[model samples]
Target: MSQPTDSSAWPPPAPRTPRHARRRKLRRAALTLVAAMAPWLAGSWGASRSSTCTPRTAHADPSFWEQVTQEPEEAARLERYQAEMQRGHQQASLVLGEGRQRDVEPLPPLQRRQLTQEARRAFQRAARIRPTVAEPHYYLAVFTFFALHSCAQCQFDPAIATEIVEELEAFEALSPLDPRLTSLLGDRAILYTRLSGHATPAKTREYLERAIADYRAIIARSAGLRQRWELTYGNLAEALMMIGDLEEAIATYRLAQRHASTASILLGLAVAMDRDERGVEARTLIRELGPDAVASWEEDVLRGDTFYVPQGEVHYYRALIAETRGDINGAIAAYRQFEQSNAHPQFAPRAAANRAALTRAVTRAVR
Candidate 1:
């Protein structure tokens, strides 16, 4: 059967729409938890393959007419399926306190689990009824992700992460032309990146590579949407840097700068350039941002008020800047601060090495 093209019939509206207001509440809840766990977990970007049916070809499909000729039984079945999906969605939203002004009073553990399971079962049944439709899968993914995130006892598990990714992929496959596809991709990419933080070195690289791909795809899909491009490019650059692709990371940060030279982008660009041996350019960028701006950015990150920048990365960059300026004590101090923050497991050892090297140089000079 041909998939329905009607927005109302499948995929639903974007999160900003009144019909999807619950999404905003879910986002707030998820982000609140994310802020406590990791500062870099928020923000959105994405891209996907175009559907085979072009606008011109859509009108010529024979099955398009068949949709209008559905028998009463089939029509009734579809209505029931939609109702089931909506019921699940609404149940999940209420459990999460979708539009309530006050925060949801914390539910007892047993009651919470029961309500969450009930909502999950409803969405699962809806998916079984209409496997080709994307809406059920989309909600399932969202509900699962946020539910786990909001659960105080739930640790970040790779198995659950994989399941969420599969659900998102199903939605993407079924709704390639949907406007929300990019946002979904972006969320999946962020999930991968977060998973990488707790993975082994080999697995870390694999996750970062996947994240980089998704961010690039988002950049491509965003096109003239300058803000989206800017944010995605910044994210892509950070992923590249994580995987030690300094040259590409530098280039990506520059591309992001063209769209909007936000402080986070500039800081990323400076760090990438400094690492790539473009110290002069990197220092110049820092000067443009100034010490006050860097301090402000760092404060926001430490306070968990910022997105798209990892915590403590600013201290690492500051150490580099201090070292370049021949301030051994200041450089060592900054490196120690970076270490104390315990951020970026991949870079912590490097910060220690640099600090040790500076210590050795200072001792030799004293001799």
Candidate 2:
């Protein structure tokens, strides 16, 4: 019961045992500590967590895995959904075109509707897979619009109005706050433009304003987008014109033309200039495009010419010039004649709107 009084402490505590024994004892203690921590460490950072969290690797960066790691599972699910959507789209195109609409190569009504529904399913899956991504909601809105909200060469079903509205709301929620924070908003804007056709003034006005704001916001962030330059600006101009803001629309068209000297932008600029009471300037602008314009777009795609002449676009501009110069009847007739031969669905709505407006204006003028 007597405590050791010697400073050596009872022969140095038995020499800490043999060096080999000491090693074993130390190892045993170390193992015991590790065993105590094993479950906690495993639960927090196991093979499953590490293996499952493969970092996101962007096509632009081979080492973007770190960034993607923040949401690795979501990224994988998103990729799967995108691939599925792509597959569905390809299948839909092949089946609808080669099977039912082989005569014109355009989608038959039933086929188009079916494809849209299938696409909707894919997009819905995508939205679930990557709730953070905006593209899924955008696609959902698109498929809904195609299948339900619109019809011309393809008949639109009025029965799906509520569905379309629901999908659009979803898209809007997924949409960013500031002037279309992402390209998803751009897609949404285009979809809404179509919806704007039969919408009341209140609805149409709000949509047009949003579209214009989106375009301006996009222009402000010109650093990020380079591929869809012409399309974005051209669409913005169209949106502004729809709202009857000729000045802003013309400027936007010109701005877009500066970035990309496409015939469509030129045409839009001319129309806007004429509406702004600058018919001479508009004509000069059209003439400058020269044989760069075409008489008609043969490809059914109105994407601008690089070196080839933009004949159809020029003619459209010329007619716009006359209309801007108070020739309402002339513009209406020109649009009507062109509509009889034109096939692009994107253009039909605007062309029809212009035609209707011109007809009304003419009727009033005559009265």
Best by TM-score: 1
lDDT of 2: 0.55
Candidate 2 at residue 38, lDDT? 62
Per-residue alpha-carbon lDDT of candidate 2 for residues 208-325, written as tens digits (9 for 90 to 100): 6765675666667666756466777778877776567788788778767777876667766776666566757876776666553533321223332211111233334545645655
Report every candidate's CA lDDT: 0.69, 0.55
Off by over 4 Å in 2: 1-139, 142-168, 171-181, 220-222, 296-318, 321-367
lDDT of 1 by residue, 163-239 (tens): 78878888888988877777666767877876776677788788888888787777678767634566677778888
Candidate 1 Cα errors over 4 Å, as ranges: 1-83, 96-113, 145-162, 226-228, 305-315, 321-327, 333-353, 364-367
**Clash pairs (backbone) in predicted model 2:** 56-68, 292-310, 293-309, 293-310, 293-311, 294-310, 294-311, 294-312, 295-311, 295-312
